[model samples]
Target: MSGAVWSYSENESVSNEVASAAADVAKGASAEPVVLEIGAVRAGVRAPGAKLLLKGPATSDVPPEVAAEAIAKASKQLQPAAILIGATRYGREIASRLAVKLTVGCLSEVSKLSADGNALAGERNAFAGKVVAKVSCALPAIATVKVGYYAAVESAGTAVTESDVGQVNPLVKVVSREKKAAGAVDLRSAKVIVSAGRGVKKKEDLPMLEELAREMHGALGCSRPLSSDLGWLPEEHHIGLTGVTVKPDLYLALGISGQLQHTAGMKDSKVVAAVNTDKDAPIFQASDYGIVGDLYQIVPAIRKALASRR
Candidate 1:
């Protein structure tokens, strides 16, 4: 019962969790689990009792064709009972292509997998985080496991084994990569966020929200309509269930009517405060603090108070 795990990084910790999970699945099964690392420059992984293999210093991100070829080579040699991959964007694509090449069934985003008698049982969420279901598959299977699902465990294992390097293909060459410029604050990781909606109207009114956010030492964010419809803010700053999910320490929604799609993404915030003219707005239900008044008059007054304090 041989198991295999792959990584795109030379650093073993990148796929260490997946390797450990593979080892756990292969425990007491009379087979040695192998941790295979595939890097542009070099590839190697570590576990207490499992086998570790490092290939070369190839590159950082693995190209789809190269990943497919590497998995194919390892499959031919190991005949692994199962292969476990992290369910990242790249991981999912690689696992799917490898499964097709290896002629095996591929499970995706599995939260749990255990060998039960003659079958492998998998538990995962479905229907957009609404339902949980279990699935079963036979041996020689492949699965893309969720990152935070299972804990990585370590135990005793054999000494390291060095395998000959596999074929290398340098088809697509990366020219360069650059990071995007950020504003004074980035809302994705902001501890506090103050957002506005269509009720604020006109692009000119955004300065009020910006002032409030600046006074609070936070970033200003908005709903899709405010960003996309009016072009008052960049689309990147939009926050809703369809957009980025934030767990800010405080989230202030001003002039925005609460929609479930928007709230679902922000409901996990530590503290939520809302300012809307309508007392019956859905935002009130989700807010830890609420102020009912016209945003035009109240927002400026709030800004003035904040300015006075500074």
Candidate 2:
């Protein structure tokens, strides 16, 4: 029962997040928490416990296929208690492959993780975030952790250690890596976010909301339809169960109807304030403050209020 608890993520930000989760689980299980670096030590990827450098993949571009092989090989020798991977697109694939390669149980997109006796217990959202189910698996299991639930731990860690996984042949090769769309932004860590939805009349009007976001020193986001259906914004701006999940200090929604799919992503936000023309819009139920008015009129008035303060 007293073995190492490992955390791994190709993403720099999510690496720290996963490490925080692993540190807590390791504490409950009375095991050491280790952050595993795929190819080289990333300066940005800091965690709570020891750092392990797996020196096998030529570069950090180790595909999920190769990452699984390396981690599986290392786990066999280290005999870890559990492996927690960040629940990003790449991390999900790596966790799945590692679980299968090592013949271990795997949990996906679980939050509030803890060590329960000889099992790993976590909460998973179901029914489109309407219901949360408690899930667990025996020791030596693999789990993909939900993001934004835990704050990143940047405390000092033990001295780094190195292990060579030897050579790994990837099932797929990464010939090129291009940046996301032009307007893409990493909304995970944004403290304040003003999101849009179907209520906006035209794509040209988005700048009005964008200006408001800038005045508030917050980022702009959107529900799925604004990006996926209407193409008013890039996919990165989309917020929903299928899109990016965010937990901001304040989420100011304008013209958003507040469907479950959209609210699911930002449910953890500290304060939710929504403005919708429909007084009965579902967003009001989820919001801490709801204004039944037109965003077009309300936004200008709010700006005037802000200006008067100055």
CA-only RMSD, every prediction: 5.8, 1.4
- Ten contiguous residues minimizing lDDT sum, candidate 1: 2-11
The runs of at least 3 residues in candidate 1 whose Cα sits more than 4 Å from the true structure, single-residue gaps closed, are: 1-36, 40-57, 112-123, 147-165, 168-176, 182-310
Point out where model 2 deviates above 4 Å: none
- Report lDDT (Cα) of residue 71, candidate 1: 67
Give residue 253's error in model 2 in angstroms.
1.3
For residues 1-310, could you state the per-residue lDDT of candidate 2 as single tens digits?
5898999988888899999899888885679998999888887886767888899887876778888899999999889999999998889999999888899999999999989999999999987789999999998889999988878978654678999999997757778989987867878878899999888999999999999888887899999999999999989899989999998999999999989999899998999999999999999999999999999999988888978888
For candidate 2, list the clashing residue pairs, or say none: none
State each model's CA lDDT, in order: 0.69, 0.90
Count: clashes, candidate 1: 13
Candidate 2, residue 233: lDDT: 93
Q: How many backbone clashes does candidate 2 have?
A: 0
